[model samples]
Target: MRKLVVLLLLFGTIAHSQTQGFAKSSDGTPIFYRTFGSGKPILIINGGPGMNSNGFEALAKKLGEHNLTIIYDQRATGKSKLEKPSEKNISMDLMVDDIEQLRQKLGFDSWIVLGHSFGGMLASYYTSLHPEKVEKLILSSSGGIDLELLNHRDLVQKNLDKTYRDSLAYWDKKIRKGDTTYVTKLGRARALAPAYVVNPKFYAMLAKRLSQSDRALNTLVWLDMNRMHFDCSEKLKTFTKPVLILQGKRDIIPAELAERAHKVLQNSRVVLMENCSHYGWLDAENVYFSEIGNFLKP
Candidate 1:
């Protein structure tokens, strides 16, 4: 009976244990990563070129219930900070390399890759570079496979009233001028928050997450992408792995972008959630989890 009790305790501890650490990238940048559960690995890449991995912790824990869920701060964000932020240190190629380094450090020959928003673009780029390292690809409210998404005006701009737009412009100017204080960041995040979800209740939560973004890093990535003419369409066409494209019908990123990717990816499925915006989990929770859970099932 005592042995049985000990075994139960051991199992309980194992079930809840979380592993976290930093993995050195090719350029020797320490990328922070955390893992939950245990099984086939699924790396959850959160949105934002400059946002840290904190916003996805809840989502990671939920997915971790069955699969070994991994979430990491991309270089120059959260715990994965470079000694100095520069175009040379941070770029599309280097960012992709960081993901590869993390995979190697984790000892994953190949794993399921799930990326959200901007992360979708990054994941698609990563798959294009290293198709053999990806078992499956899941894009959630993705930014699409090319820079075409940038040509369209953000839904946030349309959703904002003159007052909010003015506020956003003001804060943005301040941020660009090297005034990235908490107040400045929060101001910009709040002004742009409404367009992120259909439900108003989630605005504050989304705003808080957005406020944590690193503006300088975000700029660096965008500049680098422009310099390299970042486009994954050609490479994505050659990828034969299973791909799932999940987008909210009412998202800031248009449905056409998702469709474009669907047409490009050889073996891809696209699901559009109704009454949802940029965030499907927050706006259409059931549909979001259901689609992903079903897709990831063995």
Candidate 2:
């Protein structure tokens, strides 16, 4: 019995948060989550609000070597359930609550929250609601909810590439002329959006998966996030947790916004991935991992 007990303890301590699917959200959405390693918990909030739990595969592996890394498919994305589109019921606040619920369910009292793009905005709101729960904050290719920065992003997109520039011009002309289904025909590959891909191999894999996706959740969530345009600059200043802000200089999001956000944070550091695009994880994986590891280190 003593030997068996010791063996069980060792397994429990060494085992990663065994990747599992569980029913946590009260609304009946089955959130899928995965984890590896065992240390300070790091929760990764994926972009798109509708993006799946897959993009973080590379990131998880790197971080999982030391820290307990947790990534979940948000309520309406991936394998999570979605509700009928409505006005008041589906709000960002609810999404925040879901994160809190997931954390509580996972037996974590506190966690390092990571948000990328829309996820970053979500994290800002999250830190506001539960400042005490966040051990640290990491924002990647994102900033506080500033719609103006998106306009700045538009200008930056103009100088990206000759082909890309012309395509945007054409798309803009069509959209301005009342072409509602513009992106549907042009596809994501033609827009300023596609320039964000840093790795062709990864891009190809995503493209294949995207083509096979049964739902338009990712695209819809992106539009919803833009339309929501969550403004929490006031709340951003209230975050007491140490923050690490990351942005790509060549990104449409613009690294300057990250600098501005860094100023508002209580204790924050900005990491500009030079000449990289929005997909800094793949664009500058080594730098990103090193920086993240440094920030989380004891």
Candidate 3:
């Protein structure tokens, strides 16, 4: 009876460690994070200058099956809150610092870093700031190491016909008028969903995820990034660590952007997924995971 009780207690403690929790950032802001699986640590940063980390939960779980995967809400998104989310509280430097602080709290001296979309930009910035702390770098549908992505017209928007554009405009007006209900958000997301995925079937899922974004944070982050002229290309040139730039051929973000990153990153490799869009995992699940799995292998 005593032995069984001890074993059960041990299992409970292990389970607690694998679940979700908060890590206080440098400025004492509690950053919400969730962990999955067990092995080498891999921190997955979701995009959205103001987006929460929930959208990456499925990806994290898949990665977690082989390694310890960590996903956290950025400073002001999801469960992570800031007392006053002003320009002073949020900046590119602060965002990078938050990742470092989380790393310290998590006790990982160095670990794999994976960033998706805008999250890839954050990961690049983080790597630029602390190259030594990153064992490997994975940029999935990344936004490149510079701000050039903003210069290009959104392919998704361009492809959208007048009807979709009109719908988007309608939702934008509602959102601007402070109607931030899920319905309004979902409506906005649905309008943009078609461009996000290659298959129409995944449109609803993509829209659901897109609707969860925190617009204020997104705007704030972009504002800060633009002010700082966010560019890590020079720093990445000096980084000799292994980097995997995985992008989809048909992604709204053009393939040339990934190629440009590959050129600047000294020790980087680019893998373009044919027929896949921004979300390669959804568009080409087997190939996506296979490439990631192989790259991460010892």
Candidate 4:
């Protein structure tokens, strides 16, 4: 049975005042969430097929200018604590259901959705399932449904240092074996950090962020997604709502994918960031947010 879990902070006076806690998912997972700003509602879905959403905190703050932004750690990630960890519990269906439930529980008629990377893929799927629930859709550096088509594993591996690449086989084995140790998780992030960012200076920042995250690399979830290879291009083709596609010119995801997405979603607008990589907001903050502001204007 699903239950709503509310955790109250008793130690710190300031922390207790914040309206943040967990919402128990159907399979009895506690999903942590926080709300920022106040206006039209907008939920920012982060990438990282299994990475925590807390890393987008600063991005959420920047987007709060005209919307009540919502950010949350997906199940088994960040502050979302799970009683029992299993790949079976990490399906895309469950993840999308969690978003719908969160929306209903929060009492929003409908709201804007901005998804980055894997989060963008999830947002697209969510729109396909429940078109009436999404006001606008923003897919940033997200690929289409076919997991194989989105495969940049080669790029990621090539970008890693020789030593890291040599150790990857060992790390992959440990991850597949369900080793949730901090070292294993942090090591994986460090190895892939180079492929995700263009700025070398941000490499340390990325490593530090991953190190601090309540990291849970659910390898099975990734494996299952690739196996199923779901595609929702047909649904997107018929989607009439406003859609925006954002991609970085230097991102490993490839700008062609975003352009293809724009073609599939007829009403979508595409924005390609110059001199930027995967993390456009980090590499070109001002331009990134400015484009978002313009696109959001009525």
Candidate 5:
């Protein structure tokens, strides 16, 4: 009877660690995440300065099968609550602080951080700030890291054929006037443009998530956060772990910028997909999944 009780206790301890979470960010914004599988922990952050968990469900399920992945919505987005707006607070630093708190609360000593788009920007910045906490890093179709993207957005957009890009003129008008809602609307067009394995379902799901999001300054999610402020690029050079940067051939971030990040990182690699736009995962879902899967596996 004693032996059986001991075995049960051990099993319960292991099970509890495999998948659990119910926490909050430093601002008291309620935060939630799920841990699945059992192995090295991989924390996945969703894109969009406003995207929540639903945007990452497909990618998370794929990663969870191999390593324990914790996916959470950023504060004020999805189900998570954000800190009340304040003049001196609520900066990107706050975003990184939220990640740190969530990880500590979940008992993950370390994690392989994966961020997509805006999340990619956050992950790179976070890894730069706390290289000690990250085991590996992966970014997909992100425009956040390259400061030059500001000056070169035309070159980035020029990658698209004239016929297709003409559709975006409507967006340029809205962006110049300081509109937020239209920025979110263009996010789908930006993400799901090419005529390939386009998933209306995914786009619709993403749209729904944005509609319900507490997104403020929607345009800043990728560009502003992605920008390396005073300590960013200089700090990114300090990362020693392996890095993988995945970009679409026609995606907004210049192929050159991806190369620049690789050149700066202690060790990194870049993969460009053919006939794909910004959302390489959707443009080349199978390849994207396999690329990240192989890199994250032990």
Candidate 6:
């Protein structure tokens, strides 16, 4: 009976370690985060600059089997709560500072960082600010800091079908007109779905998740964040650490951007997944996992 009680206590301890919690940033913003598995620590950042960590839950769990995977929602997104959210409070610098503070709060000296889409941009910028703190960097389907150079609007529109494009344009105009409601955001997600996935069903699943999360689509954050002070290409070139750039051929972010990023970085490798969209992990899990596994291997 005593042995059974001891075993239960042990299991409870393990479960508690995997539980979700909030790391308070310097400015008192509560950033929600979770830890999984154990071994080499890896910090995974989600995109949207406003997206919660839920979208990457599957991938994080898979990677967690070997590494200590940590995922967090940025300020004003997901479970993270922010008071009086505004452009001044959520700039790129503050976001990077939040990451640093979170690391300190969690008592991790350094960790591997994997940023997906817009999260990739954040990871890159964060590494630039504190390169010594990041052991390695992974950028998934993320373009450079300057959105204009990537031609996201033109490339995404060109690939999408006419129906999707028209719908996206209409919703975008609505969103710009102060209609950033949940329904309007879901409409935008549905319209942009084609650019992110080859399978319409996957898009449906993503749309459902988007609606469930109820993430507020803030255009100002997207605009001001992308207009960063630093040049990602030039800054990344200075880093001596290794970088892995994962890109999907069919993604809204053009493959050329990843290729260009690879060319600029000193120790970087580019993996262009054929027949995969922005959500490469969903489209080609085997290839994605294999590449990540190989890179993460000691």
Per-model lDDT: 0.90, 0.72, 0.88, 0.77, 0.69, 0.80
Model 5 lDDT per residue over 56-163, tens place: 766666666666778886766666655554423346777788899998997877889988766777788888788899999987766556455566746534654565
Backbone clashes, candidate 2:
0
Pairs of colliding residues, candidate 1: none
Tens-place lDDT per residue, model 6, 97-215, is 88998899889899999988888888988988898999998989986644534355687777689999899999989978999788988898888777777767799878755554433
Runs of candidate 4 with Cα error greater than 4 angstroms are: 1-18, 148-151, 158-188, 211-217
Give candidate 2 misplaced runs (Cα > 4 Å).
1-17, 153-156, 165-187, 190-194, 198-202, 206-229
Question: lDDT tens string, model 1, 52-103?
Answer: 9999998888888878999999998999978899988999899899999999
Q: Provide the RMSD of all predictions against the true structure, rounded to 1 decimal.
A: 2.0, 5.0, 3.3, 7.7, 5.6, 3.3
Quick one: best lDDT, which candidate? 1
Model 1: how large is the Cα RMSD against the reference? 2.0
Off by over 4 Å in 1: 1-10, 161-163, 166-170, 173-179
TM-score (all chains, Cα) for each model: 0.93, 0.80, 0.91, 0.82, 0.76, 0.87
Query: Which residue ranges in model 5 land beyond 4 Å of their true spot?
Result: 1-20, 144-146, 155-215, 219-231
Tens digits of per-residue lDDT, candidate 2, 29-75, equal: 56678887777899988776456778777777668778888888777
- Show where candidate 3 strays beyond 4 Å: 1-17, 161-163, 176-179
In lDDT terms, how accurate is model 6? 0.80
Highest TM-score model number: 1
Residue 164 displacement in candidate 5 (angstroms): 5.8
Count of backbone clashes, every candidate in sequence: 0, 0, 0, 0, 2, 0
Candidate 6 lDDT score at position 273: 89
Q: Sorted by lDDT, highest first, which candidate order results?
A: 1, 3, 6, 4, 2, 5
Which run of 10 residues does model 5 get worst, by summed lDDT? Answer: 191-200
